[model samples]
Target chain A: MTSEPLVLGIETSCDETGVGIVRGGTLLADAVASSLDEHARFGGVVPEVASRAHLEAMVPALERASREAGVRLDDVDAVAVTSGPGLAGALLVGVASAKALALGLGKPLFGVNHLAAHVAVDTLEHGPLPQPCIALLVSGGHSSLLLVEDVTQTVTPLGATIDDAAGEAFDKVARLLGLPFPGGPYVDRAARTGDPAYVVFPRGLTSPRDLERHRFDFSFSGLKTAVARWVETREREGQPVPVDDVAAAFQEAVCDVLVRKALDACRTHGVNDLLIGGGVAANSRLRAMAEERCGAAGVRVRVPRPKLCTDNGAMVAALGAQMVARGRTPSGLDLLADSSMPVTVVAR
Target chain B: MLLLAFDTATPAVTVALHDGRSVLATSTIVDAMRHGELLAPGIATVLREAGADRSDLTGIAVGVGPGPFTGLRVGLVTARTLGHVLDIPVHGVCTLDVLAAAAEVDEGQVGSFLVATDARRKEVYWARYSDRRTRVDGPHVSRPAEVATPDVVVGRGATLYPDAFPNAAGPLDPSAADLARLVATGSVPVLEPVPLYLRRPDVAEPTARKSVLTAR
Candidate 1:
């Protein structure tokens, strides 16, 4: 039997310099060096700090990944790197390193999209995805829906957030609630003991009037504003704001709107398969509600493990391997980093 | 002995190779924003021009910066990787020292000198040095207009904000020759090349969970 192609992936789309090695769908090694802590104090990623962290971490991560994979750098068949949709400086570090490694090893280089890789990663864990699935990606930098015909080719965007991604909203709201930086995990923890149905937060861009015009699009900025107003009112009235109740209620509002739209897309496209990716997919409420809703609609849903759900190198590698298997062209050494690179571009 | 030296802390990427006593090859690409894209190719070209391969490398040297995060990473990553691949020890020379070295050799001055490079966002990475102890004064990210008194001020940061240091401090000459000499002699120190990000990223992601390393 022939062996699977050995693919090495590098990710520097954000604060982490992630290096991973994969044999087909099996993850051989995953090494991530994150500058998240440095960014946390600033309440976000400092572009300059992230770029430097990626630079310092690149070689060490590559070495760790190689050792973990039990393979030499020369053994890597093709090198894949996240080339865009991130901090330009951060993305460049990985791109430049990948180019050097590829040139030195005489291997092909595949520049993959940070967002599409999130969707592609489900294949590594859940096996091949059903054709024409609706993909909902929610992360610190992005929130979008895609009609993915195949993981390697044809990712058509349906709609996206106009302002303030869901993850950003979560962080901002958590901060407003005095939860902490990186609001997702904080809200997730607080919601565990509170009631999700306690307060009715407005569903952004989902009103009966707005739905007709921007049905699939999302807007978390308004929702974040609503949370801020509610907290202000509570403080004005000399009332102690129950943290768990607010966390649960706010999370429910977001989860309810997200699930409703996701299933609506499934029905609209006549597709029964729905795939969830990105950091927000780690939400317990989102996962539980999605299972409940998709089950009732007879639609299949797939979510990767928590580690894979967040920004990492394995997903980029998985997408790159798919491109190679499908005979896709490799990128030139002159490939530049695009901080706002659109998802439709194949990264050639 | 042949050594490869480069610095990406500033917009300009300067590369050089020294064969023990003299310079064999040197190249500098000026692009404040494209250090990551231009650095590796520049290094490869410099080495090729010197008629040296990876196996011929005796040591690798880089100017570890208090510079912009992006450019600094590109140089450090490339130098460290080259050193690891070639199985040679890598040295990190302060960007200021490199400037001082260049000043000493080119200007033929034998006294103290001050070096400063732009840290962007309205700040400068500054340092002070003499022939004996190279005193790294401030890697602080602050406005150049606010730099304190110094003996000599040089590098692009000084050129951009001349008012930052208006004393007879000395000459403001910028060159790559000193970096080359440091690489050849293994005189630079060995330190972690992490960026000196004085502030946080614009967006914060809360990490309340204790680290896995600490949890167990």
Candidate 2:
């Protein structure tokens, strides 16, 4: 390997087929193909549909990334792939692809964790991470709080959603509001013009008693039920539903609980740096709220650009480069895709 | 043409390395729920036993399935990825054809038989093939009782429902060697590596929008 290894990363953990090329800490190319439009009719991502889409898009995305990077496939020093905590069939496409690439090119392979990759991505936008930082990951499938001593090595999970993930909550609430699929952005847009104080939505897992037992853990199912019940009551009363207000109120509740717990974890753990990631981190309200709260707490906040926050191969590439630079051992040819791979195993 | 072939459409995971004429090495493991974990190691073991390396592969042949969604994609995606990286052509063969081609039949024998594999949900994915190994009919999914019985039946589906198929024959799962052989001899059409999901997916699109207002 050269002083700056050129690593190619493949991510098909969900509905997106992403390929990225990176040299050391610098990103050269990032290409993504999404099956969001196909899943829209279903109101959510269908695992089978997502898996089929990945098979169709993997080759094109790889070619596009390589072309955009201005590098040949043989020039890559290593191959990295997301191998877990995703839809089973979806994860297989990327893992299998990475294996083939590594075998064919005779390069080292790294099977990285999807969640830690989210935390590692911030390093690409902002320099190397400060040791022992806290990360809040909110996505369609997962929501968790992690303590990262080193993204390339160790990650400790502090808490996770007990029920629906943050993104899933948004999608369910958006459907109740008669909004389109992928409710995060639509809810954000609708919340922009409305009053956040319209209705007092429940803040789940934040009560004094709840905190004593599960401090950092989150629960959005109760909040989702609250929103659904409120809308149902309004309909039963023959009242025109205030869609914007409900959206604003719901968004407020989610952001409030998320920001509160994240900061709490940092304060309690005596860690000063905090990073927010995952698809839901792309929410404008969440970003602003996190920044504001962290600013007040004298804690530094790091969030990657919106594109990096969502599922992308650049994150995997970034993580892979760090592993290579640190002189970590590459995975054997028999690496497997662990559908329920925990966040602590950064690489396997 | 040197080739690597594998199939994960059934409980059995089969991997083989073959030259144009004969199979060098083959391994088949019957692991019900470990296809994702077992496939790569299986491939590596076969390559080692065959005294070959990954770089020696000239092509890849995969079993595209009318089988379970999760297990079927494992083989196809791996083949596609290997093909893309090696810059070689990849061929997709119908899994049922792999089993039919491996059947032992006399050269002059002229008859039609059924090749059925388990499709889960109390159904089987089956097709009809002549003694010459040409697909004569089917590639359909239906209940075992509903399918019209042929003179001879083969594959896991036959063993699954013995009463429906009294005349069952050799081999349950498709052999990886047969997949390579079929690709080498041009016995099956080389189609796009798209999966053959015989039935619709389990999930469905939303039928209508929920109303915000209820009748007073």
Candidate 3:
């Protein structure tokens, strides 16, 4: 019996150096090493810090992934790497490492898109994506709505954040509240017990006039500012800032608009499946709201397990395996990392 | 031992194949911005020219620079990955040392020589070598005028700042053939295959910046 092709994927688009191996849809391994603690003191991911960490972690992650998968490196049929829409310095580490690995192993290489990989990751958890699906990808770097025709070949951007991304706002607000660096989970944790209606936060780009131009685009900068101003007013009047209430209200505003527009996109496009991916997809509230609202609207929601939702090599490898299964051309050894790569070119 | 050597630390993306005793093939492209796009193909060209499969390589050598971090990391990461996959030992040769090693053959012999590369921001990454093999002083990043160097100079820093490095001579950057030869002959120190970044990353702790928080 001919077994499925074994593909290896590398992801160093951000602070994590992730290596994943997959055989068809089965996720054999997803090994990752993060430089999160190193960047914690900086309060943000310093590009240089991330690039340095990737170089240090790339080999170890690859070794661990292959070992965990119980496959020799030579058994891998193809190598895949995230080639763009990330920190240029950070992306180069992965791209260069992958190029060398593919060259050394005499295997085909696939330079896949980070955003599209987020959408394709769901296939590993659930199954092949329902064609003509709507993908809402929200992370520290991007908050975009996409229409995926074929995850490996075509993805159309509906809209993206004009200012701050969804997860970036979480970090900023968390910092304002004296929370830790990542702040997304901290804000999520704080919002759970707090009342969502305590202080009404302005929902961005939802106004009638704003909707005319940015119906699909998100605007979280305004919401982030409103939270700051509200906290400022409370302090000016000698009222202690209520952290829980603010976190809850702010989280509610962000999630409300995201779910509302995502479902709207699904409904308008006559699509039944809405897939949520990216770092913010790991948020419990975002997942719950997406599932609840999509279900109510007669739309199915698919989110990879929280572990697969965030950046990881398995997602890139999953997309790559699909590319191989579909008989797509492999990327050349000279493929450059496109820092602003559009989601349209799913693989290069 | 069959050796593969490559360097992206300099503007030139260079790759070479060596069969212990002599160089088999070499490739170099002098585009500073295209290191990531060029290095792998450069390696492929050299291996193909030498009729070598990557599995035939018994070792890998890389020029770890005091060069710009982005380009330098490309070579280091590639070299490290290639090493792991090929199950071969990878050596990090100081980029400056490689330049000096080549200069010795070009200029015959020198009591001492200096090697420098573009450090940008009006500075140079340089070192003073007692010969081709023994580095006496640096691997320092400083303004060209601030460095007191031996009159014999090699590397792009001399070409870029001839006034500060007045008596410029020899190859301006490392040659991969020279890097391969140096490693095959064991003429220089073989450090761990990590970049020799002589400076800290240019980022300040969050404490130095004003917080985005409103004044309370």
Pick by DockQ: which candidate is best? Answer: 3
Model 3 error, position B96 (Å): 0.6
| True contacts reproduced, candidate 1 | 0.30
lDDT of each: 0.79, 0.88, 0.90
**Could you list the CA RMSD of all candidates, in the order they appear?**
5.9, 2.3, 1.9
Candidate 1, chain A: TM-score? Answer: 0.98
Individual DockQ of the candidates?
Answer: 0.22, 0.56, 0.67
Candidate 3 per-residue lDDT over residues B109-138, each given as its tens digit: 556778889988898999988777889988
Q: Model 3, range A1-348, lDDT digits (tens) per residue?
A: 888889999999998899999999999999989998998878888999999999999998998999899999999999999998899999999999999999989999999999999999999999989999999999999999999999989899999999999999999899877778798999999999889999889999998999899989999998988888887777767998878888999999999999999998998889999999999998888889888888888999998888898889999999889999999999999999999998888888
**Which one wins on lDDT?**
3
In model 3, the runs with Cα more than 4 Å from the true position are B104-110, B148-150, B207-216
Q: Give, for candidate 1 chain A, the lowest lDDT window spanning 10 residues.
A: A97-106
Model 3, A151: alpha-carbon shift in Å? 0.4
Candidate 3 backbone collisions, by pair: none
Residue A162's lDDT in candidate 2: 91
Candidate 2 off by > 4 Å: B105-110, B148-150, B207-216
